[model samples]
Target chain A: MILLEEVWRTFQVGEAEVGALKGISLAIRRGDHVALVGPSGSGKSTLLHILGCLDRPTRGRYLFEERDTGSLSELERSALRQSRIGFVFQFFHLLSRLTAAGNVELPMMFAGVAPEERRTRAQEALRSVGLAHRAKHRPDQLSGGERQRVAIARAVVMGPSLLLADEPTGNLDRASSREVMELLERMNADGLTLVVVTHDPDIARRARRVIRLSDGTMEEEAP
Target chain B: MRAPDLLRFAAGALSGHRLRTLLSVAGVGVGVAAVVSLTALGEGARQYVVNEFTSLGSNLLIVMPGRVETTGSIPFGGVTHDLTLEDFQALVGRIYLIRSAAPLAVGSETLRHGDLGRTIPILGTTASYAEVRHLEMASGSFLPRRDPEEAGNEIVLGTKVARELFGGENPLGKLVRMGVWRFRVVGVAAPKGRSLLGFDMDDAAFVPVRTVMQAFDRRTLFRILLEVRSRGEMEQAKREVVRLLAERHHTQDVTVITQDAVLSAFSAILNALTLALAGIAAISLAVAGVGIMNVMLVSVSERRAEVGLLKALGATDGQVLAAFLAEASLLTGAGGLAGLGAGLAAVKILTAVYPAFPASPPAWAVGASLAVSVLVGLTFGLWPAYRATRLDPVNALMRR
Candidate 1:
């Protein structure tokens, strides 16, 4: 569940203030499959960052599960992200030094899970992503599809309520992209709320809800 | 994170860049090694000097002929007046605390026996020189305290001088020629080891003070060595001796030095020298700390993606900061251990090469060196670790 009341984000570049998001308002209930589609410079990533609690809305209220997120301290926001929200970046963002299981276990490690349980749960998460056989592989050792799957396992290892993926399949080939998209869709079908930001038309069409942004504001939405 | 896991993660991070990590560690290692080894050398020199002085004798006082003055180019204020046998006799008789006093009259002589002859330092002192100097006799008896007229022809050879002049044969009662005078060797003194100050007890011969004064035709004694009854009586004995000498001679020209004063002064100078050595060595440690900071800064910039990934995995700013700091400490701690081994090995080699060199490392120096390395890690690591915490996860990830 997410709610925004005319949220605005502005950036200062040199001497001018650039509006990344201009008075945008939106809401999505739990278990919803939503796609935010936009061309370059349309503030898609910025909005995703705000939704994931990595950034605060510059002007306006952002309420998650009926609680005002803007009122929380930085520490509290980090804790909220730690326990309740997950993020998937376009480039996978897996630490190259860590194995697939190590990457998957990182979220639970920060959550203070015991080593034995972290191992077991990380293995389970990898299994769910169909990457159990490659649990020991590092990011560089894995294919693009496998790396994205590993990133997904890491995102969901903490059992967050919402998953925010920003162009998760951007670096993958078409076949690997289909596999990753299918995996995300299956996760959504299992009732974990999913919000995917993508410029791919196929991904936008498959989502239960599609929101299009032309500039900083939403131009249209298919309910 | 759990403590073990945190450490594991830090170790993993350091292991990622093997060469960089090793170079930084080597920097710290060299610093610690320099500090430990240099301080050990200073400490060893201090101990050596202390041992040398201690060997001179305990509760001993020397009455030099001149008073030390604070002002002027000359350190001693008074004119060079000769301390006589009467001054030595009077100190022994008047000062109740004076256990014994020996008059020293030193000169160089060509000591000869048969065809063998060598130039050696010869000491002219009373029979009390044996007890006052704590000198042991290796063979035969020491020169007896007889009427100065009767014992004028007796001399005691030092261990090495006796061996050089007489080979393995006993030199006791054998006649040895000194200058134009022939004297009987009454005893051979035990070997006292050489000192860095160039005083070697085994290399000199001792004769009766009257014999030296008569032989050299010198009326003045070189110095008066006073042995106190106990360490506690040294100050009182010195005051009494000085008072008696000045009162009788009507001149305050004598400088009285107790063993404690010399020992304390030497200890103070050497302590400061050791501290200075350690300070100079600590500069190298500071340079090593800069190296750690440099590498850590480079690592921070290079690992932006990893830092971003951690944050995206729900790590807080504090966690990221702690991770980097932990990584630094791990490097320095390992480096310190390696340095400890290296420094100790160097000390061992030095001691082995020079058997008499006391190259033992002090415990506090070792502990402080290790502690300082860890502290350097924490101090120099702060900037890079702080920078990691300030990274915006969204931007950092996007940069990747």
Candidate 2:
């Protein structure tokens, strides 16, 4: 469902050009659980952003579900992001003012879903994440693990084909992180393509396959 | 995506910062209120002038010494001849439509009664002048139906003059002195609060025209007042008088203006003044627009992360820009309505306190103020909304 061909992302800070991702090529099949593990400055976050369609590679070809994402317009790319891809961040970026259900409905809102259907779908997503009882609670009122679950519900509310998570458990305690990983693993088993970026090797060991990156290059594959 | 949903979203965003939204609304409200109230005042003064003119009889025509087109009363550097008593005699003597004619001669003099003295305006006219102007007599009679040149030696005191000179006593047969001439007061005029010809009638004394002309040593009358028999015959009377004066004087030097012409001209000048005042007040609205711009800029800057989140959630650039723009117009639109209500209420309160002055906002001013307020929001909010749309989602999401 995802493919990258010599994807290179570069940035110019002042006058010198710096490369964040250098000539990286990788492909993951549908319904596969892939973990990207690397140290800081290893381009793991950049790769996750590219996979989520939040940022475009400076010089590379990206194919999302057999369609050329690099050739899509900004408007088309935004449509692709909402309909085909979902993202879960480390900080669980839920609007603090909205209730859990409202946070879950954000993506569908931008998709022009009707109010009644959006509400129903948001409630269903919260129930799937075991947060139906906390649907009316705001982000500040919810615990950290609950907030992450709400964010996950928001991510999957649009029923995206692929889920990209960048450091999903970076800000969680050990027990909360294990619960979040189990929830994500359960979704992956139910046939949702999952790509997770993590610093902890223990988390990566649970995935079907682990791809490790060093500097800006893919260094090794642990089978 | 939909307009209603966009509006809802914008409203939600504004609700996050309650104090800032309220302050912005207040800023625009004050501006709209200024526009509304100032125009009301201008309109009130205009209505006041119109009321005063209509109070004077509409069937009357004024023949002044100068042309209406001329700026000054003494046109041609004081070389133009004045209207005389002979012209007054000729008009009433010939024109059958003329109900009555009163020749006026005016001067400022001191009136002395026993040991007390007060300087006041003296209006010199025949008995017909009272009937022409509808002057009511509180005591005795006005000027006593005598010929213009006979010098009746009779005087009528205005209510104010009578009160100041005679106190509670009847001033009917009392004698008053004006510049070495002794005159007996024949009547006391009633209180007529409206002023005519730029002087208060209540603060004046009435005497025979020829008596004043002879005492003041003047050969010309200041003006002549001719009251037509009916309002329908006014135009014919005007033409007949103009032709007669042209035949007698061999040229038309005097300006004959019907009361309608004077009233319309007064109306036009006052309308222009009202528009000018509205323009001055509109400047304050512009300042309020700047205030809106400042608030919108701050709002955009403060919501960068939220903007990024919206984009990542699949919101198009147009949708985000429209959301911010909606927020701005909503503030100004609501403020404009509130200010309109406040200003009209203030005008009502003013009219209640002083019933003499009628203040009301014109429809054009009301519509223009509302339209300009919305336009102000769109114009001032454009830059901020554009800035919001241009934010890079990746960089914005990285911020706290």
Best by TM-score: 1
Q: Candidate 1: deviation at residue B106, Å? A: 5.1
Candidate 2: CAPRI quality band:
medium
lDDT for each residue of candidate 2 in B254-351, tens digit (9 for 90 to 100): 87878888788889999999989999989988998999999999988888888887887788898888889999998888789988988898899999
Each model's DockQ score: 0.70, 0.60
Q: Which candidate is the best by DockQ?
A: 1
Q: Assess candidate 1 and give its TM-score to the true structure.
A: 0.87
* DockQ of predicted model 1: 0.70
Cα lDDT of model 2 by residue, A51-167, tens digit = 888899999899999998988998998898888888888878888767999889888878889989999999999999999999999999998899899989988889888998878
Cα TM-score of candidate 2: 0.86
Native-to-model Cα distance after best TM-score fit, residue A50 in candidate 2, in Å: 1.9
TM-score of each: 0.87, 0.86
